[model samples]
Target chain A: MKIGIIGAGAVGSILARELNKLPENEFQLTVMARTARNGFTVLEDGIKIFHDIPVHDILSVKDTFDVLFIATKTPALLTLKETIKNMTHGNSEIIYALNGVGYDDMFVQGIPSVVYVSGQQHDEYIEHFVNQKIILPDQSFTYLDRLIQIIENDESIHFDLVKDKHFEQVRYEKLLINVGINSVTALSKNTAKIFEDDSMVRLTRTLLKESIDIVNKNSQTVYISPDFIDYAMEMYMSYPREMGTSMYYDVMANRTTEYQYIQGFVYNLKTDDHPPTPVLDTVVTLLSGYEKL
Target chain B: MKIGIIGAGAVGSILARELNKLPENEFQLTVMARTARNGFTVLEDGIKIFHDIPVHDILSVKDTFDVLFIATKTPALLTLKETIKNMTHGNSEIIYALNGVGYDDMFVQGIPSVVYVSGQQHDEYIEHFVNQKIILPDQSFTYLDRLIQIIENDESIHFDLVKDKHFEQVRYEKLLINVGINSVTALSKNTAKIFEDDSMVRLTRTLLKESIDIVNKNSQTVYISPDFIDYAMEMYMSYPREMGTSMYYDVMANRTTEYQYIQGFVYNLKTDDHPPTPVLDTVVTLLSGYEKL
Candidate 1:
């Protein structure tokens, strides 16, 4: 099966390197960027790991693919929807590995996956800082099985997505996690080091509670536990102190942020039945102000 | 009458120049900083206004004043308690022209005043931006009367203090304004330009409403109108777009901020009768985190 990845950013670069572990003949991998480049380098624990994946410019693509991964920042995802649709046939399986939610609806055959892979990209290098876990909702896919068969045969790549029957619960859990870590880190413009401050941790828990209240009100999504707030706080403490979240890096670099789809998405879901989310609303306002600025 | 100014920052420098408007021989004025400086230059509307006021080293100060003005930033006020007390005699009238509230109780003769002068000092110059109006509580002072009489003679310095019939209302109004503008500007690292964005104005109103809720619950203070939020928003729009608040400049320069006495002063005033201030509470957390970072 021919595989194609659309971006070569931090997450997409890691995706490319992990996919290279698959057997060469069965998987024809093609990584795409705006301009064709040699490869990407990722730094883990201050050590360099280079991936020499073949990259193609999106403007010059000639052949269609059997499976495609839409790997881009949340702001860049919607613009690539028609291009992604044009590159795949009816049998192609497209997986969206993004930081925020609410972009999958733009695609007809879009398979929204809860991407757990986290890292930051800088000039000439990307920093790999977190787990390489991708989860897909348990559903049928036509050509993806062939790609899964080859991955299952070798199984060297630990970043491949697998089916999960309880994806609804997991999806909300990931959203809640981002709502906590991403909002604070981005707004503070600090790394996970901010978690060391006890008041910072308390603030994160407050934001999580506000998000949890909104998710519980939505019947369409699974309800998350209040205990998850404590668990997520623990997870934040587990990260390397100097590491930055994707949103944090975005703000530091003065790029577009994914706040709208993460915090703003949950905020827009509030009905009259749901309690008001004053903290979340204020954060969203500040984030919007930053974007315009 | 002997007069002393404790700081040489934006407010203090402006105070020296404004006081220079009075005849030189009547009021023996001295400006203090860590080291002696020649003078300061203020940039108003891209024009330079030089104040050739002589500056003295605070360590080498020798004279006790009949009246002294503490014009330092809020963070620098507490540490100068001993130095300030030493510089004043028993009959001295010490005035604190600070940005935030709750600093007067440190001294028995500490007379708190609401100063409306606003500016940001850069490398070698200060930018004056707002009105130089000072409002003092309606209370009698011994040496303060002669100094007021001196000001009433020349009547040239526009920044001198005058007694107010309802000083509590003005004090709380100034606190609420700081709670709104200073918090947003320091956190966003932007200037009054942020008010141009409608969402930012709305966010400011939300914070003001939160602060007003707490002040109304305190029986010791007068209740502020909810309509003051709108008035404050209108006032923010009138500032120069490039102008920044003192707290904003402090954060930009990585100096200690005045949050402890501004938002923090209001947060600590909360009683059981007050409603929860989730937005203000979250903002305080972020500002505290920035202080630690």
Candidate 2:
């Protein structure tokens, strides 16, 4: 199998490393990044891990892949649309391991994956904090079965295939979790410990509730319950006290965040019938101010 | 008349200098500060202005004053209660030019002043941005009349003797303004320019409206209109782009903020009948987290 991954970000780098672990005889993996970087490095358990996977600039990649993973951030997807179209063949299976929802329509035969991982990139390597199982749609796609078999057999990473009918719920659940945890931590400049305070917990819960409302109202197949608020809070507390979100790192580093796809997506979904999401609205405004600054 | 001021903070230092401008023979002014520093300096319109007013450590000050002004922050009031008791004579008039409300009972015979001033302290000198007229009780109290006369005669400062019956409204209005502007600026780490964004303006207005609701519910005599939201937004916009509130400065300097007296005062006034103030609650919680950091 010939596999290609676009964008050598933290997500792409981690995925490339994990997939490269498969037997080289069966899989030939290459990363098509914006820059022609040599290789990618990731820090696992405070130890440095290096991968020498071949990386080529997207414009230089003339060959098509059997399976392609679009691991770029949501905001960068638009700029990569033409490149994505040029690199995919009729047999290619494009998997979107990106944040946000309702973007599946952008791809002709794209499969959205709910990525359950956290990593931060330094100058030389990415730092991996949490590595969990990714949830993908369970369908009759030939490449998906092969991809699942490859991932399921790997000892390092985990994968879950959910029914296609129930994939929206899983994706939105991940979105709400990101919306609640990332926004607060980014604004407060704290980590999971921020949720330990009762008031912080209440505010996070209120924001999650507002997001769940927007999701439920916008999607007919996905319905989020208020109880997910508690679940989200518990999940945040389960992370390390100093575990910072990608949004938090971006704000600290003075870089643009995926807020347009996360909070911005929810803010844009406002309708007449849905209740006013004052908390989400306020956070989105603050995040916007932060981005401008 | 012998006058003494407590707390040599930004507010205290400014009040001491303004009072020292009075006629030397008619009034004797001294500042009872936590430290026996030589003097205080303030920056006015980029010009370095120096004031050599007498400063004495509060514990060492033995003289009683005919008029006393408590210019300490709300948090420092508790630590100075005993010192305040010892420094006031039987005929002393205590004027609290402090922030927040319901603290008048802390002094047996106290007068509250709604101060409309903005200043930030550096290592050597404080920067005076705005020095507007202060609103004091319009009663016939002897020291108040003397204080007002001295202030009214001064060319640099201004004072307004408001009716004692309507003083709470003015005081609460100033408190609400501080609650809205200080908390948001502190949390966002931006200056008044943060309010320039429409979303920021909306969030600030929402928080202010919630504060006004709480104030109206707690006070039968004072009713804040929803239009005050627009008024407050305009006021914040009128400030210089880089103007940072005292709370913002405190947060930046990693010092404890007066949030307890500002946002905490409003949050504590919550009752079953009052509307939920989620924004204020969140800001307060974030401020609390900031304090811990």
Candidate 3:
């Protein structure tokens, strides 16, 4: 099976690295990147873990792949739209391994996957802080089994094929986590240690509760427990004190953030009946303001 | 009249400079500062404006004055409590020219004055951004008229003697302004230009409205119009694009912020019936967390 990963960001590069470790006879893996670089390196601890997988600029790729993974941030989807359109054949299955939800309909028969990984890329080297597992809904798709087989073969990477019934709930749980952690750390310019503060802990819980409320109201099938608020807070507080979210690093580097798909996505979900989320609204506003600068 | 200014910071230094310009025989002014520097310089538009006033270390101060002004930040009060007690006679009137409200009762016969000036000190030179009038309540005090007369004599500084009945209202108004602008700019690490963003503008108005609601509920004598929300937003947005608040600068430099008296004061006022102020609570928490660092 021919496999291609679009957008060689931290997530894309990490996925490419994990897939390259699979049996070459069964999976021919290639990475379509924005840059012209043929390969990327990832740093774990003090050692450099380099991946020499074949990489082509998205625009230069002409061959169709059996399976394609869209790993770019939501904002980059627009620029890659044409490239994606040209590279995917009628039989190709596209999986969006990104932070947001509700983008599955944006692409032709796209499968949205909740990525439970965190990393930052500096030039060609990516520094990964968290690499838990990727969760995908177990739905009827022609290439689902082959995709899972290739991913599951890698010992370093974890994959979970959750039942379709509980997919939305799992996706929202991850989204709510991102919404709270990313927004606060990004705005405060602090790290996970910020959650150690009592008031910050409360604020994080409140933000999570708001996001969960919206998700629960929008999806009748998924119900997020109020206790998940405390769970998320404890999870963030458990991370390294200096561990920063992607949004925090983006703001520090003055790059456009993934806020549009995270906090902004949550903000757009609010309706007349939904309770107002001032904290989330404030974070989105401040982040949007920071982007303008 | 003999007058001594305790806590020779930007406000104290400016007050000393303004008071030194008065007739020498009518008023004698001494500045008690943390440092032993005899005087400080204030730069306006790159020009050196030196203030050559007598300065004394707070611990070494011995003389009692007819009227005293406490101009240091709230955090500095603990170190200077003994000095303040030693410098004020039984008839001496003490005025706290600082940020935050409800501190008047903390000092022996302390009069809280709302200072509408804004500036930042770089080494010995302070940069004046906004030098609006200082508003004080007109009440029965031994040296109230003399204090106003001396302040009125300075053409560069403006003073307002509002009715004593509405003193808390005026003070709360200033507090609300700081609560909104200081917390947002400080946390966002952006300047007043952040207010230019529509979402940020809305957030600022919402924060101001929350503060006004609290103030209006606490004090029946003072009614802040809902329109004041727009007025405050416009006022902050009108500042120079690159201008930063003291709290913003404090966070940028890793100095202790005035959040305790500003947002913390407002937070302490919360009761069971009062509406929740997650925004203020978050700011105070984050700032408190920053201070720990």
In terms of DockQ, the best-performing candidate is 1
Candidate that beats the other on DockQ, 2 or 3, i.e. the better one: 2
Instruction: Provide TM-scores for the models.
Output: 0.89, 0.80, 0.80
Record all residue pairs in model 3 with backbone atoms less than 3 Å apart, i.e. clashing.
none
Task: Show where candidate 1 strays beyond 4 Å.
Answer: A34-37, A54-64, A82-90, A155-158, A190-203, B34-36, B54-57, B60-63, B188-203, B240-243, B252-254
Please give the lDDT score at residue B31 for candidate 3: 86
Model 1, span B1-293: residue lDDT tens:
78898888777887788777766677788999877988889887789887889889997998999888888877877788889888888888888888788877888888888988877777878887767767888888887777676666765666666888889899889988989998888777678888888878877887898899888887475979889988998888888787788777776676888899999999988987677788798888888876765
Lowest-sum lDDT 10-residue window in model 3 chain B: B156-165
Best by TM-score: 1
TM-score of chain A of each: 0.95, 0.91, 0.92
Error of 2 at B42 (Å): 4.1
The positional error of residue B210 in candidate 2, measured at the CA in angstroms, is 3.4
Backbone clash pairs in model 3 (N, Cα, C under 3 Å; residues 3+ apart or in different chains), count: 0
lDDT comparison, 2 vs 3, better candidate: 2
Residues B18-39 of candidate 2 have per-residue lDDT tens digits of 6777788988888987788878
Instruction: Report clash pairs, candidate 1.
Output: none
Cα lDDT tens digits, model 3, B123-218, are: 657777667456677677788676676566667544443335677777888888899999888877788888777777777777777777777777
